[model samples]
Structure formats: C-alpha cells, structure tokens
Target chain A: MTDDATRGPDPAAMLAVAEEQQARALRLLEPDGAVIYGAWGVAWLVGPGLMWLSRAHDVLPIGVAGAVFAALLLGAGAVTAVHVGRRTQGVQGVSQQTGALHGWSWFLGFATLTAIMAATARAGASDDLLALLWTALSCLVVGVLYMAAGALWRDLVQYSIGVWILVIGAAGALAGVPTNQLLMSLAGGGVFLGAAALSRLRRRA
Target chain B: MTSGPTLNGLDPVIHAESRLRITATLAAVDRGDRLSFPRLQKLLDMTAGNLSTHLRRLEDAGYVEVTKTFEGRTPATYLALTDPGRVAFATYTAALRALLRPTDGGSA
Candidate 1:
C-alpha cells in the first residue's frame, strides 16, 4: 500500500483527457455524419415532402402519384446508399464499416417505404385499428433498422432520432394525430439541421 | 486587408489546391471528423507521395496530426485537424467572406 502523502493520478485530469479525446473523435466523425444526414435530408425526407405537396395539388391520382413518389424516393435513397458504400468500400478496419451498414439500411428503408405505401393504398383511408397497427409496425421496423445502421455509424444522436421516428409514427397512428407528418418533419429534418448547426458552431468556437 | 480572419489562418502557400480542398472538406464535417489516407487520396486524387508531402507540411505546421495504428495486421493512417488548425481555417474563411462580400446595412 502507498503512503497517504503519496500523490496518484488525478481523476479530474483523466476525465478532462477523455473529454478532449471525445471531442477529437467528434471532430473526425463530423464529415461522414454531415454527408449521411445531408443526403438523408434531401433524398428520404424531401421525396415525401414533395409527394405530399403534389397530392395536395391534385396533380394526379392519389395512389398513382404515391406510387411514383415511392419510386422516386427509392431511387434517391439507392443513389445515396450506393455512393456511400462505394466511397467506403474495402477499408479493412475502421468505423468506415458504418458506411456499408448505412447504405444497406437505406436500401432496406426504401423497400419498407414501398411496402407502407402499398399497404396504405390497399386500406383506402380506413380508420380501422388493424390498418393503423400495421402501419405503425412498419414504421417501427424501419426506425429500428435505421437505428441499428446509425449506431454502427457511431452517430448516436442520429440513431436515437431515427428510433424515435418509430415512436412518433406509432403514436400518431394510435392517437389519430393528424399532424404526424409535421411532427416528423420537426423531429427528423429539423433536429438534423439543428444538430448540424450546433456542430458547426462547436467547431468554429 | 481590414484585419479580419482568414478561413483557417492558413497561409496562401498552405492553401494551395490540395490543402485547401482538404481543409474545406474537414471544415464541412459535423463532428467526429476523421479522414483515412485512402479516402483523402480518392478525394484529391493525388499520388501517395504527393499527399504525404503535403500532409507532412501540414503536420509540421501544427495544423494536422496523423495517427498510425494496425487494423487487423494492416496499418491504417488517420488524419485529424488540431483545434488550432480549425480556428485558423475558420478565421481564414471569415476573412475571405468579408473581402468577397462586405456586410452592409442591406445595401442593394
């Protein structure tokens, strides 16, 4: 045993060092994070937003328009996924593995969206509990898939946000919340932009 | 001119093509920013030796730091910007912006 007078490593200093390292890691992680979310914002969320507007304008048959929108959305998601995957391919050992996971999840998400649109179309605006449950489950499935992918990417905040999308979708379906889309826009798109702003500020400071 | 900051306080010599692109790429990242050598190579399309020379200059200037560790028996090189480097880049950018478009009271 050491004497009481002897000095040991300072816990506070250790914590500070860890914090600094974390900050550094965050700095390094920023680029990939921005690209991922930026692509997600433009491709995934924007497609839905555009479809909503088109439907509002009665530009085409609702079902037909939704199908076209789903195709477009899927196309966009595929492009981004493929790009990220191509960029990070063949990197042996690094967090770059997250890129592959993200790409696959994006493709999976696109497939899920297609399914949701099909199911909803078949249900024909019904207020049935079964329809709501199925939709909610679909949302949950997609959200969990995205969460897993984001976790692999080491984007914890984004992963949590993605998982929460399921919660919001399910809650909206169950509670018959009409503003579900708006809420998601705020949660998914708004939160992402906010996080980006905060990150930029931190870097500048 | 008017004593404003540059983007990264990077000297013009440092701000040459490759380094400038690298700094801009790094600056645009959110958080947890790391660039692998291969990624950097792809991004800039520079030969390994050319990239290494520029990286060395950057490291010597205290702008970037490199880490080399084994990745399952294969070695990987990671590049990160130091805090000072970030500040300098941001300052340099601000200066460039000020020069390019001076802020006025919404002047037409």
Candidate 2:
C-alpha cells in the first residue's frame, strides 16, 4: 500500500483545509452583527418610546422627546461607524468602496427626505400630517436602504428585516398619531432586537 | 481509454499543507489588506518559528509580501498576498478541484 508521503498530500484533504481557512478569513472581515443591530434596537425602542409617551400621556414636552430621539439616532450612527471602521481597519479594496458608498446612501437619502418634509411643513401642512409624513418617510428610507444592503451582500436575513420594516412603516401610518409612535417603538424596535438575537445565535451555530 | 487526472497543474509553492493554509487565509482578505503576523499565527495555531519558516518560503517565491513597521513602541510584522500570489492560489485551488472531479465522478 502507498503511504501518504509517497502519494504526497491528499488532494481532497488539502481542498477541505483550503475551504475551511477561507471561511474563517471571511468571517473575520464581517463586523459584529449583534452589536450593530443591538445599537439600532435600543435607539428605535427608547427614542420613539419617549416620543410616544410624551404624546400619549403628556409625560414630557414633545420638544424634549424630539431632542432625545435625535440624540439616540446620532448615538446609534456613531456606534455603527465605529464598529465598521474597526473591522475594516488596514483593509483596502472593493469592500471598502462598497461600504463607503452604502454609508453615503443612508446620509444622502435622509438628507433629501428631510428637505422634502421641511418643504411640506413650510407649505402649511398640519401638525398631524407632518408627523405622519416624517415617521413614514423615515421608515421607508430605512427599509429601502436595508434591502439594498441585503441585495448587495446576498443576505436573506437582512432582506427579510427590510420587508418587515416596510410593513411597520405602512401600518404605523394607517394607525395615525400618538398610536403610530407607539407602534413604531414597539414593532420596529422589536424587529431590531429580534434580529440582533438571531444574528448572535447564527454566529454561535 | 481516458487517462486519470494528474496533479501537475498545482503550484508547488502552494501545494504544501502549511503553505496552502497560509495562502488561502491571505487570499480571503481583500486585496491590499494586510494581516499582522501574530494574528495569522493565532489563526493557524502554529508556533512562531514554524510559521516564520513557511512565510519565508512563500516570500522567496514572490507569492507573499511581508512588511515590518512599529506600532507605537513595538515592532509589528504584516503579511499580504501579492497579485501574483493571489493568481497562483486561485489557479492552485482550481487545479485541486479538477483533480478531485474525475475521482469523484464529477459529483462535487
């Protein structure tokens, strides 16, 4: 019988090792999904929750709630930026370009949406209409962007979350005022938190 | 009669098990990205001396690039696969697959 040394390394075994090592390297390139989703979950849950509480129970001034919401959103953005930056540090290539472009899409999309909403508000839209417009439009932007990201990465989970967010946005708009805020806080935040947990479990498995 | 596939197409530099693992790991990183020596050693679970030896061989073949720099007060070594290295690894894997295909009757 021919021994391993005489035959050289088994081609099949070598191929298996190659596949395993490549998988490990790819895993290293991904940012921590749980941390990213958890940050957004907290922001969505608490930010809109505060606003909903203020509107529904008059527990706090709407202005204060709005400020808190803005702060939380900014905080979530910061966390995402830091996490992604750390993961890609010292790496350069098409991935870096893709990430930069995706990040800009979020900023540009929101900026444009804000401009349109501001114009509506300036043109004598009622407080009720303005509130609905802001919530629905923001959700729409997030949903579309998430789907785009999912398509780019070919991640089913991300794409599913995007679809779910769109449903929440639509339902919240139909539900109307104060209640819409509550719906978004609970439904939108719940999905983010759930996604975070799922991501963690997936990694472990 | 059809002849069986041969392993002649495999790049000798990347055919060794240790070197194959190293090359595969580096190829997975995005082009122009560098992996630190300590990180690679930990990932591969190899001793410092052993990894250095394989790395030197790869470097000699122009399939790997090693850079030394100071991070803060400490010296650090980083490794990357050159363009030629990436091409070689790709060709090697393709050849490996082709060799296995006939033995497995193309089931893959």
Candidate 3:
C-alpha cells in the first residue's frame, strides 16, 4: 500500500463533508467513458470497411457496393451511439466536465479533418495523395483523442485503443489509401465494438 | 495569530451523504434538465421512502425543486437543483478549499 493508505487515521481527515460528498459524486459518475468512443468508432470505421468490400462489384458500378456498405455501417453506428448513451444515471458532476472536454476535443478533430480535406480538394491534389493524407491525418486525430480520453479518465483500455488507432493510421498512410481505409475500418471498427461490448458487460455485471 | 479551518461555511444541509449525492448528481447534468426520481433512486441506491425523505429536506431548504409529470399516465417525479442550491454548493466548496489549503504554505 502507498504511504497514505498505510497511515493510521489522522485528525486532519480529508473526508470533510464537502470533499467527501464531491468524491461520492465523482465515483458515481464513472464518466461517460467509452460509450461515445465506441459508437463513433463503429460508425466511422466499419462503414468504410464495407465500402471496400463492395468495390468488388464488377457487375455494378466500380464502388457501388462499397458505398452501400459504408452508408449502412454509418447508420448502424449512429443508432448504436444514441442507444448506448442513454444512461439511467444523470451525468455526474465530474462526468459533465470530462464529457464536455472529450466531446469538444473530438469535434475539434473533425473540424481539422474537414479543413484539411477542403484545402486539399481546393489545391487539386491527386486522388491518391488526397486519400493518403486524409487517412493518415484522420488516424492521428482518432489516436490522439483516445489517448486524451484515456488520460482524463485514467483508463488504460481507452488509451490503448488510442495508441492502436495511431498505429493503424500511421501504417495505413504508408500502405496507400485503399489499404489504409480497409485497415482502419476493420481494426478500428473491431476495437470500437470490442470496447462497447466490454462496457456493456461491465454495466450488466 | 491565525485560526485553523472550521465548519462554519460547511452547509450542514448539503453535507449529508445522500443529499450531497443527489445535489451533485443534479448539478452534473449540463443541459439543466431535472433528473427523474427513478434515475436518482438507482444511482444513489436509495429506497423510495428514503429518497423522498431526503428530497423533502432539500426541498424544505429550497436547495431542490421537484415536479411530478405523467408519461402516458404513469406519473413521474423529476428533481432539479434550484438556483439557491447551486449557489450554496459553490459557497460550500469555496469554504472547503480554504479549509483544505495550507495556512502557511506561501513559502516565498
């Protein structure tokens, strides 16, 4: 045990009424944690994965199948997020702060992604280069956000997911846009769904 | 000479565990909507009678406001932190910080 835990009860008990009460609120919060993360992940990553599969529709348009798959996965992800985020507990005080921070951080990432995409499109960048840049940068954003979320909540799993996304994103950049999208969709979606499932299981238990 | 920290600013009303949890929980919602009674009951692990009793105390102190609404004929009670309650919680925390801080830590 650390020094504080080992120490006998001191007169200066930190559990002053207000402090103790705040701690209770924090504990009850458990934070909005990974539900949102998983939801976005499944939606963003898995939808694209299906798109890649549909590109095999030689009988149809070149990417018709892929487009259909992406749309469906994206739809599913959105629905899942709404369903999961509907928590019985009103947001806890600590959670309120963190959720706001995390939500904004991701929003910033999306904004950045949009800016980069728009700039590249205006520049008339080649399709391949544009795709590569988008995938790489997107990966970095996802990774960093997950890391931030993990750090804020002191959850290693969340942090690891962030790290994993970074790796996938980085690796995809080198492998070209198609490969990058595929890897991100498969690995990223898996991670999101896995985390979501774990969260659900914990809540059930 | 400086006196040590005291509980003068501590809100005895909000200090109790259940009420504290309730207040903090209500305060946490960013949208400023009332928390349903069943939600509080589950979150705080309080029995219906116990939850209502503590809520009554907070209501009496003007720290919380409770309203009853019907969701398709099933009556529902929602609890929200009043303006005074928020102010009280803030004042309580400021006092708490002062008490927790070192009296002579300004070792410049």
Q: DockQ, in order, for the candidates?
A: 0.02, 0.31, 0.11
Q: Give per-residue CA lDDT, model 2, range A112-140, as digits (tens).
A: 99999989999999988988888899889
Lowest lDDT 10-residue stretch of candidate 3 chain A? A1-10
**How do these models rank on DockQ, best leading?**
2, 3, 1
Per-residue lDDT of model 3, residues A21-138, tens digit only: 4555444544343565566666766565654554423344526645665576567556644543565344334345555676678778788898989998899998678767877887
- Structural similarity to truth (TM-score) of each candidate: 0.45, 0.75, 0.56
**Which CAPRI level is candidate 2?**
acceptable
Tens-place lDDT per residue, model 2, B1-108, is: 112343465666777788888999899887867888877876677888888988887898889999988889998898999988998898889988788776555563
- Cα lDDT tens digits, model 1, A66-90, are 5755685567556656655665443
Backbone N/Cα/C clashes per model = 28, 0, 2
Error of 1 at B22 (Å): 14
Tell me the TM-score of chain B in each candidate: 0.75, 0.86, 0.84
**Which candidate would rank higher by TM-score, 1 or 2?**
2
lDDT (Cα, 0-100) at B107 in candidate 1: 64
lDDT for B21 in candidate 3 is 62
- Candidate 2 ranges beyond 4 A from true positions: A1-20, B1-11, B30-56, B59-108
Residue A194 in candidate 3 has what lDDT? 80
Over B1-108, each residue of candidate 3 has an lDDT whose tens digit, in order, gives: 112233454666665556666676666554366677887777666789888888887898888888887879998888888888888777755665666668796643
Top of the candidates by DockQ = 2
Any residue pairs clashing in model 3, and if so which? A51-A66, A54-A66
